[model samples]
Target chain A: MTLELVVTLIIAAAMFGTGIYGALSQTNLVMIMMGIELILAAALLNLVAFWRYLHPDAIEAQMFVLIVMTVMAVEMAVGFAVAITRFRSRGSVEMEEAQELKG
Target chain B: MSVQVIFLLAFGLAAVWFGIVVFRTHSMVRSALALLFSQTAVGAMFLVMQAEFLGVLQIMMMATEMSIMAIFMVMFMMDPGGLGEMDMKHQRKLSLWAGIIAFGGASGLALFGDWGPIATQIPDAGEQVRLLGIELLGRSMLIFESAGLTILTAMIAATSIAVQPPHRPKETPDKSKEPYQVHNHGGAA
Candidate 1:
């Protein structure tokens, strides 16, 4: 209900939008992964904003955000590891060329 | 507006600007750096919002992650400098429309949706942190332990996968190659 909360939420929304656009438009796998990271970041921002605004007394939301951060870190590491593996085998990380997964 | 609001507005604008540059730049390294700046600004916003521990954690984690990401960009990108003028993006128009629609929907929901009553009584930062610590080690101990284990597993898995495994009769390439002989000096760039 506060202006601070409203502004923060708006920023989070913009960030999520940008992430969607980047993930959809990028041809490179790394770029797409970056987009996904953005989306995760946006989600984090939203969670923290809501928690700080609506439920500051409750610690559950903080814990949830921490868990989300852990997931984001692990996901990025694994995603890039896969990208490197693909690059080593296929010589490029283009999503279009990953047709072997079309089964 | 209060000083806190002013700081939030400033940092938020910087974050949003850098976020836009993350996708706009052609150079992979530049994009990574831009994202880094954007994320750091977001962390600063958290600090201004009075979540000190979370804000610090956000900055530390993102800094480390983004540095590793930049190193990976240089290692794996075919043209890190973008001198080759590669098309880093595709379906631009559709992407723009999609982004706009998403923003509109989210903003609408955020502005008009009925969220439960905002808590009027809030504890101070010290009390909040104390309570958070207790909750983490007490009721949520299992979840925290599981997350820690998963993160450890992820780190080990990433390292094992990334490092080249020794295949046939371990020939040490680094040991075999002599350190610079300085023969017929190739002209410096």
Candidate 2:
């Protein structure tokens, strides 16, 4: 592997680590969502890196990335809507206290 | 190192730094912005990798997403202004160790893993984009349509769930005691 690709992969690894830290440690639901976003970004970096460096001619990776991006967007939308609903009903988005699933 | 490589290194480091800052900051809005900065740096790294379409989409999409995200932070988070100094985290030591272990595993694999052959002949940028378009509209069309339909269903579900009243009949009795009476500020403040 080239130095640049290796560096990109390392960056992905770092971003993943930070994201896991945030997602696990944060009690705030929004902060956890931000952590998940970082994880998705890291995944995207890996996909783009692999495609650019290893199989540039295949072209299918681009579509895969696009689909992944679409999925991310949809996930954020549903997630935040749930957050808003939770805030309106329970007046809180803290994951620790949101134990009751029926709401 | 070439100039491109230098730029890549600079952007990569910035991305990782901001990713760390996202969790370290006390303010929720600031944390979202830090995430935005980190994601933007990743987009720049994509540009450094010479993937223009993906890079541009990353910057634009993340800009929109994170902006809306800041609004949510202000709406839902307690003491988002950071005046209360309420700790927003839990399980700090355990999570730190988890993160460190994850990094160790990833780095070890990245360094030691046997990645197969690298393609030596990459098509020109324009040619690559053209092929990508054909690939998307051809073999990937069914996948795209399915994803589009799924997104449509999700949007309808989310809107219905979020826009409708929080409390309605058929909800469990204990929860509906004070119908529609929501405790403001997370029931903590």
Candidate 3:
């Protein structure tokens, strides 16, 4: 296998591991956010790697990624806004506490 | 060794990592994060398959969406400060059985899957862009422009709704004003 593929594989592996660890181990909301960010970074890395290696001609995917980035920015802003309102209503961000009505 | 073997190895390792993360983490946020990572690695596989457009979209959509969701959950959940211990609820036998079933199913699928032929000609990013523009907006400039306008309008609306004055009503100037007075009555003994 080429070195590029090797490195890409390694990175992908590390990303998956980190994502799993973050998802399984931490209960804090912010830590979970960090874990999500790490996973996203890993996925982006995969995209760039594949773009460089496979489709040297296709620019469509790159543009799509850009659009996705814009969408993500909007989503993050909206999400944070919603979160702020929720925090105002309730004083905590713990997931366990949210199980007040699990009928 | 063949490139296919290497790629397969990467996929396997990444998948295993994803499984481990999903199994180990108790928080929903962490699980989402693990899902994001797993999705991204799949995006890379898309690239390898010569689907550049799909690959990029996968990363952008999956990663960004997951991040936003995580943040939203963090902020809007019962605790804003994340200052409390979480109760980990486990139905022990169910969890173990679920894990076994998932692992077995995944392994079975992986072992039997048939990947199609490797794409011979992968287009460049620029060529793909040109094709996409033409395909999406062929003789339809007005529609595209209108879509852009709609987006602008949405942006304005969202901003107006999200941005608010940072002071409480009581903190602002009090509208009502009256003279303070104390009434006293003398009692005869």
Candidate 4:
């Protein structure tokens, strides 16, 4: 059981690392959102692992997971909407070219 | 190793691998699909952990969300197919260092941290779900309701932001022509 938790945590850490790379390095708005999605997934994985291994009886952990999932969904929605608006206005969603909002 | 551990490792590896793929791929569509697969693998991990409802919810939600993201990629990307061999990254060195540091720190914590005694007895799947439901509707009712409201607001905000504003016709004054004389309607009446 301890081994499983460690493995899961390590995996989640790897994912979190990859997401950090993606979110920080990606140029496009959609790609950035994808990175954010992965990060949130990592958080969810950690939450579930803890709930299962450490506090199996605590339903509140599950509730927290659901809330995180909702946050992920809402974030994606708002992100895509912003991407759409950016594309409509500038004809490109590249972050490098978004100097208009730099101030 | 128990069957559960094996399954957990498998799904965990799949999730990490596909998460890497999401960034390695140049094609926007491929990236989106890779993210979908990664999230699905995470869902499978949830199932391996015996959180049935969460696993199903993760899979279902990610499927729809990533499909929409794929569609958006096609619509918004200049080269969705990645045929141009364009590099889509910035601050590569910094990001690499950040990623490595984050992984090292998190893994070190996981490996060294003393997480108290592991719970050996988990409720059955059905009971777990029932208790989760009760918790959601009971003590967590406020949080649940807040989340719902936030989603509704996000939906509305997204729609409004995405919708094109009505174009009002520009009133071009015909300066070349004489202005029309407006007769007093009251005097005429």
Per-residue CA lDDT of model 4 for B41-157, tens digit only, reads 999999989999999999999999999998898788756345457688999999999999988889888999898777789998999889989998999999999999999999999
- The chain A TM-scores for the candidates, taken one by one, are 0.93, 0.93, 0.75, 0.96
Candidate 3 lDDT over B52-136, as tens digits, reads 6766777677777666665555544433334344454334455345444543443343344442233345566566757667744
Each candidate's fnat, listed in order, reads 0.57, 0.70, 0.06, 0.85
Residue ranges of candidate 4 with Cα displaced over 4 Å: B80-84, B168-189
> Model 2 over residues B3-110: C-alpha lDDT tens digits?
767998899899999999888777767878888899899999988877888898899999989988888887776554454565888999998998888877787777
lDDT of 1 by residue, B18-127 (tens): 88998887777888888888889889988888888888889999988988887777667756345446676778999999988998899888888777565546666788
Model 3 residue runs over 4 Å out of place are A1-82, A100-103, B11-43, B53-103, B106-126, B138-189
Q: After superposition, how far is residue A31 of candidate 2 from its true place, in Å?
A: 0.8
Please report the candidate that would top lDDT against the real structure.
4
Off by over 4 Å in 2: A101-103, B80-84, B166-189
i-RMS, each model, one decimal: 1.6, 1.5, 7.7, 0.9
Which is superior by DockQ, 1 or 3? 1
Query: Candidate 4, residue B177: CA error in Å?
Result: 37
TM-score of each model's chain B: 0.80, 0.81, 0.50, 0.85
lDDT of 1 at B25: 76
Candidate 3's residue-wise lDDT over A1-103, tens digit each? 2444445545554654454355334444444444444545455555554555555455444544444444444544443554354344555444445576345
- Steric collisions counted per model: 0, 0, 21, 0
Candidate 4 at residue A10, lDDT? 92
The better candidate by TM-score, 3 or 4, is 4
The ten-residue window of minimal lDDT in model 3 chain B covers B110-119
